[model samples]
Target: MTRCRLCGSTALESVVDLGATPPCESFLAAERLDAPEPTYPLHLRVCTDCWLAQIPPLITPEETFSEYAYFSSYSSSWVEHARVFVEDAAARLGLGEDSFVVEVASNDGYLLRHVVDRGVRCLGVEPSVNVGAAAREAGVPTLTAFLSPETGAAVRAEHGPADLVVANNVYAHIPDVIGFTQGLRALVADDGWVSVEVQHLLTLIEENQYDTIYHEHFQYYTVASAIRALASGGLTLVDVELLPTHGGSLRLWARPEEAAGEPSGRVADVLAREKAAGLQELSGYTEFSARVAKVRRDLLRFLVEAAEEGKTVVGYGAPGKGNTLLNHCGIRPDLLPYTVDRNPYKHGRYTPGTRIPILPPDRIAADRPDYVLVLPWNLRAELVEQLSYVHEWGGRLVFPIPELSIVEVER
Candidate 1:
């Protein structure tokens, strides 16, 4: 009788278990070196009542992003993605000078910058203090507070309702999914649409993307599950599109539930596909645990053999996803040595469970490692470009996912 995030429905069954994992951004301190890192149950379950998919009830949003270090602008791929999204959303919405755009979790104004350029009034609602400050400094009007029903009401009282709301990759991070969507309901006008991007749960299970599991990610979503979740908060899907971001994701366009439009062919098609794929049945997800177990075995084998061969395997990216992969795989400082990050905040901090020091990208050039273990597999291409200097030394890039192997040429 597991309760669903959308409603208080107790019709959930366990689907996948990613095992015990440490907090993604819980960097260790020198004094706490010997102290044991807190590990939480890393399991994803599907709510049959509401069709929503999420991790077990555990950490809060404040516990996750209040002192967050992973800023969106640090990664070029993400920044470019934001720019493109803003352009497409603006055009699709047919925004004009009078229309307003609001972006939830708009870190460093990566996406809002484009909205601002089109003479469309734009504002950002970001909870993280540091990231919000960065956005304001970039001339993006940002509110530095958490979004709830009260905050949404206060915002509307000041600036009226928004016409376009963008919640990119923030759907999975919200602690109170229903409460957050209710805020969106209050913050947006009747004619407006909210485009939300959540990591696709179908992709996570089907592709064995267990590495994406972490406390920061409160929920993984499928199109069917998301539509149901939004429906609970008085919203309905206007359209939906499958996205390739973060391995696999979905961009859902939803509006107020009252004024229902003709259902998109995309919606019915995916529903039929999921039904054919047995989404409603619990047994369909039972094999996810076994798939995860195999991944753990293959990854450990690769890392151990590489260490024995005297390969200096440095890690790329200090992402939350990378933390889950490293800690779950039991990689310590002996095997990984150090990881490089583009952000200055995490450069000196050590990873949570593994306690491996995080250094700047310059470490790769200085150390001249024989092998670079790309932690954030989605950004492997960017890492390869940034670390092309290593190629001069005949170094190879390794991606440990689906299967473990080294890429000799540019992939």
Candidate 2:
């Protein structure tokens, strides 16, 4: 029996079994495709004790993130998101030149650049050397090490405690939930706050976002479970905000337990909402597998019908989430001939399990496919706007998640 990573409970109930899947971000080179690739069981479980939804760590962190391919600067909307966050956070926290900010899992300095521009001292803790080098080139000093309790203590010794520590979209990626939260506590000043952003478990089930389930993500957290995990590290939740990014994400503001701060009503409000949705009970999770299976069947039917009709279908954005959707649905190059991406690192490569070639955005206009499958459905609006020229050829966009639907482009 696999124990819960957070609470160490042995009573883990099965939620959804996605069979075996490769690491979502593991793009393959042309030569490597001929060789066998490693895949792990993509199964999720819920702990009755803590109510934390998680998957067992099949691959080690070194194997998954040492040479990361995803870069934050590739998406214009993501960069804008970072800029807005830095602006709002700096203003809200009263950050100045004297204030020190540290970002964990900082990718390419997409967010910290704004903090540096504001004259606040900032440091980034990044594990991927390639991405870390990019951040350094952009004038963001970064330490190329994983954020563990030991490393966090070393950072504190070298640079002093941070006035504000930001960990956006990285809370779920960590395998050691308790250790990671403790590390955050170690790095933050006594009075400073730690801001963590994670995709809400409620939104994941409501929207049928099963594609977000990949090997790198160790846990899916609800507001209540998140509060429990943070409290284990001697942190208290002070505030919470729901965000629209990544389907629906929750940004949590927490401080050391000894710190003087009252918990915001939003925290209780969201916790109550989760309870109303039956998230506190096991029955709330039992129906999810059926919903996910329906999505897979519906998407496959749409793709098979399109193929039989001799329609040329291609994919947009080779994101990790897209890989999960394609691999889970057993899609290959025949269904989606190829995909386009703005990130140069993924342009010449192929997706891990599906083996679909990834090309540059210019390929979409060159091919003028009859239908473009938007793989990263969360960014549908941005993609539709960028690929608007496809409408000139009477081509429509297809979204596979939350039910397969065809969207007509407005001329």
Candidate 3:
């Protein structure tokens, strides 16, 4: 039996099983398509002790992140979101030219670029070489290394303790939650703040966002569970904000337990919400498997009906979440045929497991398929706006999660 990573408890209850799937971001080159692709069981379990939803670490971080394929700059909306966050955080934290900022898992320096624009001293620590190089090219000093207690000490020695440590969308990717949080504590100055963003487990279960369950994300957190995790690393929650990113996420601000800061009312408000939602009990997670199974059935039914009607369907984004959805539903190129992505790195590659060929966005306009499946459904509005011209060809957009539905695009 796999023990829970957070509390080291053996009493882990099954939440949802996605069966075996390749690393979601493992886009394959044409030359490598003939080679065998490795897959691991993608099962999620909730810790009865800590109430943390997590998956077993089937793959190492090096294998999943090194030379990574996902780049943040490709999504204009995401970049703009980062820009807004930097602007707000800098002002709220009273950051100045002398204040040092550090971002962990800073993909393509998307957020830190805004920090630099304000003349603040900032650094990005990205494990992915491809994206780290991009960050460096964009004039953001980046360190290509994973954040751990040891690495954190090394970073603090090289560059003085940071005044603001930002870790957005990285809390879930970390398997060693305790160690990573400790590292955050080590890198931040005594008075500095550590900000973390994680997709709320309540949203995942409520919205049926099973697609977000993949190898890359090891653990999901609720406000209560996140506080427990941070406390284990000698940090105390000072504030919490509910963000709309990643469907629904929690942006938590913390500081060393010794630091002087009162808990914000938002913290109590979110904790009460989680309590009412039953996130504190294992019973809350029991029905998740059934919901995920229903999503699979619904998605498969839609694809089969579309195929029977001779409807040509393609995908919009090659995001990791989309891969989980595809692999979990057992979708192949026969159903999806091909998908398009804005990232040139994925253009000529094939999606892992499904082996669906990925093409450029221009292919969509050239072929003008009858239906387009917006894979990253969280960005549906942005994608709809970008592909509004699809209405010119009488094409409709489809969303598979939270139930499969077809949407008519307005001209």
Candidate 4:
């Protein structure tokens, strides 16, 4: 019995298997084109007792997020999402003079700006040195260190207990799941609340979002698993809400165990729905390997067929998720030719493993591809709308996961 890493639960059921692939951030060095790479099996498992979704240990966060290449500000959608989170949190916390909010992994101070705008004092705990520097430059007070029991105590000493602690889509990225939760307990005020947002594991499996199978995300989550994990650190979940951001995600509101109120109907409803949908049951997750393998096969088939028909095939978005899908599908420069990105840091680089060149998005119109693969399938709408001129040349767009389909939208 492979026990759950956080809760030590022996009853784990396989949710889905994504086979072996390089880490999402394993972008190759320019000189190591032929260097051998190690790819780990990307598998999802659900803890029966705690109802937490996770993968067997395969990689470490130090191997995934340290020396990171991704920046949250690179995406327009995420930036807007941060702005909204800050606004709502400030109002909900009744934050203003004499109130303070703190964010863990506050990349580029993207979300904290909203709290700052409300005059609610704010601070950021960022581990990535480069990204943390960027946040500091933007005038967000950022502590460039990992959030841990020791650091949490030290921060509490300096800032006192935080009235609100926000962690957006970072729970799954943490390597020490229990340690991370414990830190939250130590840092949050006695009467204050903590909100954590994570990609919904059930949605990821149901929608076949294999692109999110990066090493950085060690655990996928459902309400049952999350509540149980936090409880170990003397915290209790009070409410839960499903959000549409990041394909799909869960926003959890929690407080100290003693201060927690009766669990809301909102929490019970989602748990019941997830259980009915077989989120924690073994049989429900057993059929996953076949579904994801089909996606890999179907994508290669579509791109290869398009190539045979003399249609120029290119790619959109240089996101880490895109890297996972493309590399796992065994895409090479010959098949994809080149992809384009809006982020300047990625534009002139090549994707890891696949070695496909990445250029600026403008190059897409210049090349005028007959079919452009939308790598960030989550942003299909915006990409299609922005790149609608592809239709001027009778070009089509492709969305690979969930199913391989092409769309022709009018400008």
Candidate 5:
């Protein structure tokens, strides 16, 4: 964009241009296959002033989240991650029956269910109607609305200031970063804790995780930039924890400035790491574009060689990141043929730009394909165990990110 979304600065440098592609989560129905699909420029830039990396606000949250297809409960590891977070947060924050908990963008009540089980009052503020309905059906109180300054204040007034506000994997989804952060401030008590988990830009660059950049993710944050973003809404970063989720992520603990005394040593430690990695300057981003090009070349080469050898190569998991990888590499059904997923909503649909069919998880076993190209490589550990049956027929699993590697499962 001409101006940075966060700092409003006119100086924005190129990080990587992923070319134009449709929304990553936009799966096409059979009826719409013949119709035309729209695409937008997927260029990511970093602001020279604030060092915040972002893409243009080409798509709005309403367009994507109104009836979102992603369900957090589909990933067993993610659900367990949520459960453990709830347990730890409860014990750490001294939450009990009297504590009020609120989770923004909570999908399908995966995390809040643990809070509900503990008999604490909790609510999920989600924008997607389908997932929010699923949350309600699971006995979790849910509000089907987007988070804003006014919305957060209303929640605080009606239910009283929340003791704990959990926002996981959603800090980068909203375009209005300032407004969204203000909403978080409004929902939390003056002394309450706000926990946010987002993909770490440092690891994203070091690990060659460019596929994570998509239209839905508006911005990527380093600890330094994240500190500035938090202060924009009067929230102070008090603690920071590095997590292994989403390849690599940061768990930020914040509070209102009045109660946020001094940041923990971890904050400085992360900032130091970011500085050493050259993220605070322009040098870190200079080689990213070249590295990204290498990844695309390597993946396309593998698919071509596999085809020539008569080795069938299909995909596993139709995640949004997978769509980014597919569209960037210009892969179609000719190369990938089809993919399988656990979410039933995508069973009969096709990936937006690539037009690859999505089938059920059992199809891999039924067809016994020679090779299964895994799209959701972030869930490598959990998916490997789930797909160990591939070993029965000598079928192998392929991972495309951080480097392309093939695994021979031994059951």
Candidate 6:
């Protein structure tokens, strides 16, 4: 962290230091609870030169994603989102039966299944052995490997150049930003489109979504910074869209420099919006730490008051972002008790650092907890509908980020 990862500059400013926490997704088995758990510093810094916000690469991607706890198909909304993206991308790019598609970090074939149904050949380059196996089981041709320059080149040589290279929600996961971007360049055709979706720094600051800051997410991007990162790999930004996923994200359409002419006006419009938000300069980040602190205080106060009043508060999802929020706020089982997730892999495991138990989603209705604190608030709409049954027991849902609010759902 002494120098910026993107620009190699010594001038890096602190956006927020969330103290230290374990790798967010490192859930513990009941047997390992007696063993020591390791933690690392989760500090975010912004480069004044490049305007790319990043954290120290304390843990490698292999350590976090090898076996992998997150499966994208578990979220129904995300699956539908991926489905729509596939159909739209195919139509937009004029893809057909002869077209080929490659998705980097494609988890569990949640997206490429759509490509297969469309009679297009597709390949998923996913690192995690287990999830990649799951993808292959679902009939999506997947290569079990990380998306490095070599891997990308090999895939290109074997399958031929992709007509469309899709990287969704993974651009910030790699520490080696330039190399990863180069891999994207290597996998795509000279004239093919590359679509990358990552969390936008503008929405992160404006909405106080500090919980998304974690070790796995090494870099945060504004369109201005993203353009620089893409250029380092011979890719050029062509279009941009502001998405509501992950609280707020940017879907960047890019291509090799030869084919990437003038970028869309939307890219400039978004960059102007980010500049207006003061992200290009240091002023945008000064008050962020304070806002983050306020979020911590408000959530803790609510949890503590609920505990004191004998009102039970359990967590809704044991997502990686939730671990950051829980560890940062110093919440233990006394405040949260246990959280439930639909993902069966997390069942009977414990959240890293906090050591709160993870249970099945049915446990919530069984226990009738007074309040369910949602960790994955990005899926608020979907979760609200799913958890509406809690209203039968007079239970409410709590969201921690962008200011704390409790919602009452109608059955």
Q: What lDDT would each prediction earn against the true structure?
A: 0.82, 0.91, 0.92, 0.83, 0.96, 0.95
Pick out the ten consecutive residues of candidate 1 with the lowest summed lDDT: 402-411
Task: Give the TM-scores of the predictions, in the order they appear.
Answer: 0.95, 0.99, 0.98, 0.95, 0.99, 0.99
Q: How far is candidate 5 from the true structure (C-alpha RMSD, Å)?
A: 0.6
Sort by lDDT, best first: 5, 6, 3, 2, 4, 1
Task: Give one digit per residue, the lDDT tens place, for model 2 in 45-72.
Answer: 8899999999888887788778999999
> Candidate 5: misplaced stretches above 4 Å?
none
All predictions: root-mean-square deviation over Cα? 1.7, 0.9, 1.0, 1.7, 0.6, 0.6
- Tens-digit lDDT string for candidate 6 (1-411): 799988899999999999999999999999999999999999999999999999999999999999999999999999999999988998799999889999999989999999998999999999999999999999999999999899899999999999999999999999999999999999999999999999998989999999999999999999999999999999999999999999999999999999999999999899889989999899999999999999999999998899889999999998999999999999999888899999999999999999999999989989999999999999999999999999998999999988998999988
Q: Which candidate is the best by lDDT?
A: 5
lDDT tens digits by residue: candidate 5, 1-411: 799877899999999999999999999999999999999999999998999999999999999999999999999999999999999999999999999999999999999999999999999999999999999999999999999999999999999999999999999999999999999999999999999999999999999999999999999999988999989899999999999999999999999999999899999999999999999899989999999999999999999999999999989999999999999999999888999999999999999999999999999989999999999999999989998999999999999989889999887
**185: Cα error in model 1, Å:** 0.8
List candidate 3 segments past 4 Å from native.
none
The residue pairs that clash in candidate 2, if any, are: none
Cα error of candidate 2 at position 117, Å: 0.7
> Clash pairs of candidate 5?
none
Worst 10 residues of 3 by lDDT: 1-10
Query: What global local distance difference test value does model 1 have?
Result: 0.82
Model 6 gets an lDDT of 0.95
Report the C-alpha lDDT of model 3 over 1-411, residue by residue, as the tens digit: 378888889988888888999999999999998999999999888888889889989888899889899899888899999999998988898999889999999999989999999999999999999899999999999999999999899999999999999999999998888999999998999988999988999899999999999998999999999999999888999999998888899999999999947899999999998888788887787898998899899889988998999999999999999999999889999999999999999989999999999999999999999999999999877988998999999999999878888998986
The collision pairs in model 6 are none
Candidate 2's C-alpha runs over 4 A off are none
Q: Residue 75: error of model 4 in Å?
A: 1.3
Error of 2 at 255 (Å): 0.4
lDDT of 4 by residue, 1-411 (tens): 288878787987776666677777776655666778788777777777777777666777666655667788877778888888777877887888799788998988888766777777888998888888888898888998788878888899999999998988889988688888989988999989999999887788788887887777888888888888788777899999898877889999999988997989999999998889887677667777789889999999988898899889999888889988987788998899999888776766678778888889889888888998998888766677887888988989999977998999678
Better of 3 and 5 by lDDT: 5
